[model samples]
Target: MKHVKIAGGLGFIGFHLAQKLLDEGWLVTAVDSLENRSELKLALEMELGRNAHFTFLQTKIEQVDFGDADVVVYAADNENRAALEAVLRKCQPDCLFVFLSTTDVYEYSGEWRVQPVTEYGKAMLAQEENIRVTCAETGGAAVIIRLPTVYGLHQPYHLKLGRQFVSYEDETGKTESMHDLLYIDDVTSALAAAMAIDSGQHTIHLGSGTSNPFERTGKSNGLDYQKAHELLGFFPRTSLAEGIKKYQLAHEEWQRQKKLAAMYDETKSMAAKHPNTNQ
Candidate 1:
């Protein structure tokens, strides 16, 4: 089985990708700092822990040994640039390094430029440059996937927004803002396809290939996904309605679980406070 090391495997995209790889019968080593938004970490651990092919390591990328990995997926944020570079140095000569980049590196017109608008974009651009240079010097195969706003089940912010919108409409009768969303499954599929290809160096942009005016106020327009389609055979398969329905179902289930856990904790606390009262 192919051994893959996922940096930030506890993150949103990272966790999903790791699960997909594990399900596909690949041996997956999940290296995470456990520092990212960790609300779903326990849930993810509970779910993925059942797989015999999965392993979780709570540590920084720089501290791990990448010599045994066939593929290294960098799913962590730009803050781990130093650690990322360290991993690159220690990675096996034949290992494929995949970087999860963002569309923030491009201009509003969806054109690649040297300069980025936001600070986050600037950092991501720098991270991408570092990966490109390191891979070039080491003769390592690399793939950079620039992703758009990804949405799906267990996505914290978007799910919160959906719940807020429903409550807002019920209370104040006003509609909340929508987002230009690409389902998480589509992004995972694209990443998997990118990993399967043996082509040397590639930078691919991933999106729904169409602008949604209702979402993000038209900021999702002009992204060119031709390279992704032609090279990786990736295309968004989920429609907005279908994606939203799936997300809603998953969100409801998650909420139910959350409430049940909270109630269980409350009951335990109460029982501890009145140990002898129960006859």
Candidate 2:
């Protein structure tokens, strides 16, 4: 039985990966500061029963123990510097560490942009280096999985650059920006493969393939998800269109639920106020 500790295991990508590992009979320890614990728990129950081969740590990554883990999958993104150090300190001396980094490390948000990951992949690069140094000193190995834009079910944001406030070179539909959209399943598969690799301190780029293009006007042009295929021996099976459709469906359901709740609340309040008049 392979012991794997996943940080941020309750997140959008993390939960799916946990499900995959559970299916494969891996002993999985999943940790997350679940922002939506109730919904996530319900989803997990639907996917992997109450007594599955998975353990949930409902706390921050810094608070957990990774000492017994054979492989540690570090997936959290925000405030990650300290979290990385904590994982290194607690991981077993020989445990293989897998760092799930963003393709934002290689992001090209125009030449004049000053964002940290965009202007320079410094912060992410620093994280990669820190892990490399830690592993080298401890005789442990580390692998970096650089993922591009990931989308799938339970997606929180709509595919609108307006939400991101990106100033595209040409706002018209004629100009299209390249976004290497990788489905969540593909990201998980790459993570799984990295866990099995013995190659020391290697960095691999992961996407659906080369680069899946997304038009500013919501049209998708599929790219060969072959880079992952050639390098990691895996390709994303989910199509970008299909993934977008799922996200839209989930979003619509969520909106409907909210509207229904509001309607129920309004009816209950009216009933409470006019009980005597009705009687």
Q: For every candidate structure, what is the RMSD over all alpha carbons to the true structure, in angstroms?
A: 5.6, 7.3
Q: How many pairs of residues collide in model 2?
A: 2
Please give, for residues 26-126, the per-residue lDDT of candidate 2 as tens digits: 99888877766676455653454454688878787898989999888887653368888988889877788888765555544332121333422566768
- Scanning candidate 2 in windows of ten residues, the lowest lDDT window is 111-120
All candidates' TM-scores? 0.82, 0.71
List where candidate 1 sits over 4 angstroms from the true fold.
36-39, 109-115, 159-180, 213-222, 257-279
Ten contiguous residues with the weakest lDDT in model 1: 167-176
lDDT of 2: 0.67
Give a tens-digit lDDT track for model 1, residues 44-126: 87678889999999887789999899999988754467787898998876999998877766665454454566666677778
Task: Report how far off residue 120 is in candidate 2 (Å).
Answer: 8.3
